[model samples]
Target: MDAVHVHMTNTSNLPVEALENEYPLRMDEYAMIQDSGGAGRTRGGMGIAKQIRAVGPGIVFSARSDSHTVGVAAGVDGGRDGRRARLIRNFGTPQQEELFSKTANIALAAGESVRIETPGGGGYGAPSARPQPRVAQDVADGKISAEAARADYGLSA
Candidate 1:
């Protein structure tokens, strides 16, 4: 496995947004990988989902995040491994395609989008150890679905 990558962009060549006056290479969506965090006495932190849209030409996308298959953080004390991470492109469009875990520079056209889903943290204990209130909060925050809260955490509807 490779270390987490940190990306840097040169702002001088980037096109500015008409309203915000900032480059279009900004964060698009933010969410948690539902039910991905390990279930335990101390629930693991949820993985994050992020999207970035290319608003100009000459943009290139590159990444190789593969927690999706191998699993993310490993749990302790009999806890399980967290879900894997993923990298995808064109999400809702017909062109939507899943990308490899590792990629080099690939040209990105305007209006195209790239999405990344990070793996969740591993839990420290068993699912039964998680408190009901925390499960409820996770549901409200969209970190986990109501069904997951009930099925995984044993929370009531």
Candidate 2:
């Protein structure tokens, strides 16, 4: 074994009081990305999807997360690859812009919103090895989609 320890900082709902009611940064409003985890017996930890609506003018945002593609967590035997991070600015606006995993001072004006999706962890084994009841629970909890439950865990006819 090597002398190394790693830690991942959860950027979800980052506490920023400056953007409080002034920017309507709803910290409690986070959802799990549906079907975002890798397929495997030991289901990968779900990722967090959050959207913040900026209300004040001249607001700046900064973030850094695991990258998609190369940085995606590698799955175990028979387990599919996990999803990677994503960031979207001005999601519904004509000025919408897609950003990289790490971004520096970005200006966000009034009425603009940003959506951030953190990466999911890698799976452990074959998806089919996962229980049907667990898949159903995931669906009901909105962590994974119904289609994923059926396709990944073979819970549907």
Candidate 3:
């Protein structure tokens, strides 16, 4: 029988400073992906993107993640589905490339970087039921873009 590893504590992301201090890497970006959540009466939570570069040679990269090719969180009650996850190598450069969701043991030279974008949660209820004030607030708070509010929530500019 396959045994599942269970933990009572909730998982948490490490701070950029801690990660850099402990590992031979430099954090490029660690921020929330704006407007990645599904649009709905109760909008879904946003995702996170983390980019790191190898500061030293002989860095072996590996990861076991999901939501890459398919199997994303689906919405309910007419809500929109969440965005997909991604693992990229050398993102935003001439040699940027997509890596497998379950890759392991990839050698990284110094200055080469990797980016992991986590998927957002699915929304609840119909987007038409969402209030205009809440949509405006989302825009004001930088959670969603004004264009997204207009397009997804049917709000006028």
Instruction: Point to the candidate with the largest TM-score.
Output: 3
Lowest lDDT sum, 10 consecutive residues, model 3, at 1-10
Lowest lDDT block of 10, candidate 2: 1-10
Flag clash pairs in model 2: none
After superposing candidate 2 on the true structure, give the runs of residues whose Cα lies further than 4 Å from its correct spot. 1-28, 92-95
Identify the runs in model 3 with alpha carbons over 4 angstroms from their true place: 1-12
What C-alpha lDDT, on a 0 to 100 scale, does residue 66 get in candidate 2?
55
Estimate, for each residue in 45-80, the C-alpha lDDT of model 3 and write its tens digit. 787788999999989999876568878768889989
Residue lDDT tens for model 2, 1-157: 0101122455333355654744545443467776777878987777776778766677788886657435786789988776777888877669888887678898877777788776777778999999888888778877778888887788884
Which scores greater on TM-score, model 1 or model 2?
2
The TM-score of predicted model 3 comes to: 0.87
The candidate, 1 or 2, that scores higher on lDDT is 2
Give TM-scores for every candidate, taking all chains together and pairing residue i with residue i: 0.76, 0.78, 0.87
| lDDT (C-alpha) at residue 11 in model 3 | 35
Deviation from native of the Cα of residue 76 in model 1, angstroms: 2.0
Whole-structure CA lDDT of model 3? 0.82
